[model samples]
Target: MSDHSNNNNSWHLSIVERKFLLLWCDFIIVFGAIFLAVILRSTISMDLFLQRGYFGIIFLYTSLTVAIFYIIDLYNIFLIDFWTSIVPRIFIGVALTSLLVIVSSFFLEFLALPRKSIVFMSVVIILGMMLTRYYLMIVKRYPLNIMVLGSGFAALKMIEDIKKSGSAYFHIIGIYDDDDRKHGKEVMEIPIRGGIESFAADIKELRPQMVVVSFEKEIKETWTDILLQCARSNVQVSSAVDIYCKLFGKVPSDHIDALWLLSGIQLIRKPYFIFKRFCDIIFSLIGLFIMLLIFPFVFVIMKITSPGPIFFSQVRVGLNGSHFRIHKFRTMVVDAEKRTGAVWATKGDNRITAFGKFMRKVRIDELPQCWNILKGDMSIVGPRPERPEFVDMLKERITFYDERHLVKPGLTGWAQVLYPYGNTIEDATEKLHYDLFYIRNMSVFMDMKIILKTIATVIGGRGGM
Candidate 1:
């Protein structure tokens, strides 16, 4: 077993190291942005020096953001999708810290912490940190040097996903399979280094960061020897499933298994459960209130465009594979799926009404799910609720399909925001990768990031199911 406790300088960090760096990174970015934002807002932007008391107030609020982030685990950088991850957490951090400023102003007489400065700092810090992370991505990117011990369709998919990840550090250096025909050939542009016998020496010489053992038993001896050597050499080792999860952010349906679930890697916890529950109550209430306010006008528009009920309800799988009726704004004609028998909605789904098409694109169709959140059948964030019929069929066809049911289903989730609408078994397989990552890495900070990305998705009108 690799001693996770060892203080090795390997690129693959331990869980503990990941946690530490996560907090440390957030601390640096949040405080630096605060200090810089304060200086810019007070002196350069406002053309006046900030009073000592007000400046002190700014510092305190900045410090509080560090704690707020700590509580939410915003610093867990390994699990974060930098571009999609940082801004939302920063917004939450700034929002919580800004409240501190407002409360501080009420108590202190001389130090009137300017509300405008705090708000401006929040936006600047968010934008600045987001850009900085992207820049780091470009400069400091370290591709995960991967050597696959296979030259097949599975290997091809693995290579393709690595290229799609946009990570500087994820690279498929070569492939190794004993197929005599493929021994000197290139599969999907990745060179086939040699047969199984050549693998150990090649790995030792190349010292690739990850060795993916996806070959069949026909070459067991060669693949095993190389895996043993790479493990001994302190190189990171993975399987097709492992790379799929790391790159695509979820375990694949085809590769999921009982052992994977029992591997002692649980992502949801007490804090996540409590925080998720609280969010359900608060955000759902706010969402419902807003819906009520906008209902009259929205209802009229739907009524004129289509003749049907405003709310659409469908039985969906919830926590622990339980079932509940998920609510959404009607986005299709009545009995649209009667003939197709639970088919996927396409880009220009003919079943969709005129208003429904617009609603689906903009995700207005999902707004009614806030009520489901309030009802405790769903959460603000988690795996997107799948229909009970689909879940039953998927569980039979897909491996580890039941793993997603370990936590409460969500209205919008890691899969929904990161992946486009899943319309086929292949698409669902891909989306499941993201869903697993969300379940394994569920945190308040992660949830917050998903919520922010959901906003961006809605604005772009490019995401839905």
Candidate 2:
């Protein structure tokens, strides 16, 4: 398709409106999966048609499952990088659904459904849901067209960065800069369109989708004309930092300023905190029920093989530096810390018991923290809680370290899943970048993304401590 650069009079959905449309699309896909599952189970010649109450039973079960998916933030129109990470999460969701059906068979008083039917339905639903997301990616025309207003090394670096991003649908039309020396040259096959003097006029003339002001310093005065033109003509505009987050999936560490970090929007709001706590309670209860069901098996195995308590409690710093007892299934030896105080866990650490090693690898030890979530000291998703000892040292070592305590800690976090467990000041610094990214862009949608990444991390044993 030709670029709609000159379509000045055309109407485009605002970002918020587009997000709502994607949400509606998600709802459609979920219900469609329900219908598809039914058709698969009943269309076979070996089976007679379902009875009158059959559809009602199916509807109720489907509704509950859909609600769970919604609560998991599966409906959010994930930003480009986030969308690419959806595959393994889809697998886990299907596995959990199958497990739920199997467990329900023992308690619910519904008519017996064939086990084969349930299994087939789950497989079909998983495939259907994944394909639906890919299809919607096409239809939604996502990853808006982006135009960079620079042609220097920084601009080229931006293109290279986008090259590594799998989730965005970015189409860089060309570059524009003030450097006449590099005017007609092609850097990375993206031609230099023009210089800064004509930048606004070029943008207004071309009316490209989005203008990325990528100059090194603040260009507020220079951007006024182009910003006005873009605003009036329906093109979106963003700063370098904004585009970096959209393209790279994480914030650039060098671009952050103290003022921006301390701004009004960065501060926590009362209602947001309340809502986050509410979410922690609701999900923790559900998670607790699942943990309780599995406790008998886990407890029995640990008791028979090990010589320590089933639950391990440690003092961890919570919101605003408050102390709380964090619970987990003991994943290390009783005296692991006797000789070495507060050393980070390494692969094949001798202190880890055999069962503890497995628990750590699979993250089953974290299951009990649903209780912490219930206690309001933690969230299902946020910055990983650090021990007081580590916090004290890190507070002095890492910049903006205490800022993470602005919100409650979490069970699984952006840092935990994206990066390895912190072993040193360097690792913690890298993690801090991801944590800042999470805090800046925190939302129900982002929380879901981290949760999904956490699932992948567990399954693949990736980035483990």
Candidate 3:
């Protein structure tokens, strides 16, 4: 086996590295903005500010601003245009952050800053972020040159996803496969340069920053030699799965096999489980309290509009493939499924009442699931629980479908936020890719990111059925 770990850090930066760089840049910008704001307002000296314990407050504000920017997708370097997508989100993030800071200052006297200083700080932060992003846009405009080492289906799919990503982060320069017949042919417009024998010459000529080994089967000795040579030359060599997951934020369910699943999946640590459970309990209690406050209004509306039970409950597949009743505010007519039996909800379904449609769009229908989360039947963030009927049917057709049950189901999930409401087997397969990715990379930070995305989804009303 070629020592893949030797060249882990290469000239080319992965998606995670780029994101981390952007995060640090924003953190610096926030700190600088605070300094400039204090100077411009001339209201507080740096020494006095620190002496008064305002440094902690400033740190909190800076952290909150960066987090808001992240939640608003300002850190999404994959966005092609800075003006079209990034600029507006920057303004929204700053505004939201300012609002939060102002609200927080009212409750905590020590957190308060002068009005002029706050305004100046917000303006400086926005300008600083825009300039920083513009610089990154120019710097990352040249996509990383990737020389693929296979012309198989996996390589083709990887190419397709790179194009679909809408960012100039990766450019497939050429492909080299062992098959004699595939030579001189094109896979999705990328030429198959030659067999593995020609890889050395091609590497020198093309001078790619990364070589992606995408073979569908075990690597031959010749290919292994090529990978070792690439490693010696300081060119990054990665499996197609690594590149795909890094770029697309999801696993390639179709390409991954049993060995990949067994080896790649990380066992959930006890601390993560405990932390997740604690969050689930606390957030669920808060959510249920909010639900209680609004229940009477929802109940009256359902009574008037749909003439049905206020709460809808159904059997769902939970952790370990066990069954549990999931509760939701009734968004459909009573006995809506009597004639049709169990089925996926479709867009603009006739069964959904007007109020129910509104509820679903805003995700108000999902609040009742907090009770389930509170009861430990679900999590605040995980794979969305599926109906037992659908789960049973999907497990038969989908590979590794049962693996999703290893973690508890959630009120909102990585799949639920990233993919649209799934109604077909194909959609379910696509979602499984995200769910598996979540399972393999489960962490408190990942869960927090999912929760932030879920909030964005609810506000945007773009992902519901």
154 Cα displacement, candidate 2 (Å)? 8.4
Candidate lDDT scores, in order, read 0.69, 0.69, 0.79
Model 2 score (lDDT): 0.69
lDDT of 3 by residue, 3-122 (tens): 122123223554556678889888888877775665565666768877877767778778888887787667765465567557877877778877876788778664466888788878
* TM-score (C-alpha, index-matched) for candidate 1: 0.69
Off by over 4 Å in 3: 1-35, 42-115, 118-126, 138-140
Error of 1 at 170 (Å): 3.3
Instruction: List ranges where model 2 is wrong by over 4 Å.
Output: 1-78, 81-144, 150-158, 166-168, 178-194, 204-206, 262-269, 282-306, 309-311, 392-398, 420-426, 448-465
Residue-by-residue lDDT tens digits, candidate 2, 1-465: 113441333224544455566455545554555455555555434234354455565567666766666565565443453345556556656676667666776774342347776666677777677776666565544444557876434455667776665434566766777778877777666667677666766664554567776776556556676677777776777766666655555655556666665662366567776777788889899989988998898888888777788898989999889999999988777777988888778766777777777778888788899998997888999899999999999888888888788778999888887776657788888788778778776776678678777887778876344
Name the top lDDT candidate.
3
Instruction: Name the weakest run of 10 consecutive residues (lDDT summed) in model 1.
Output: 1-10
Candidate 3, run of 10 with poorest lDDT = 1-10
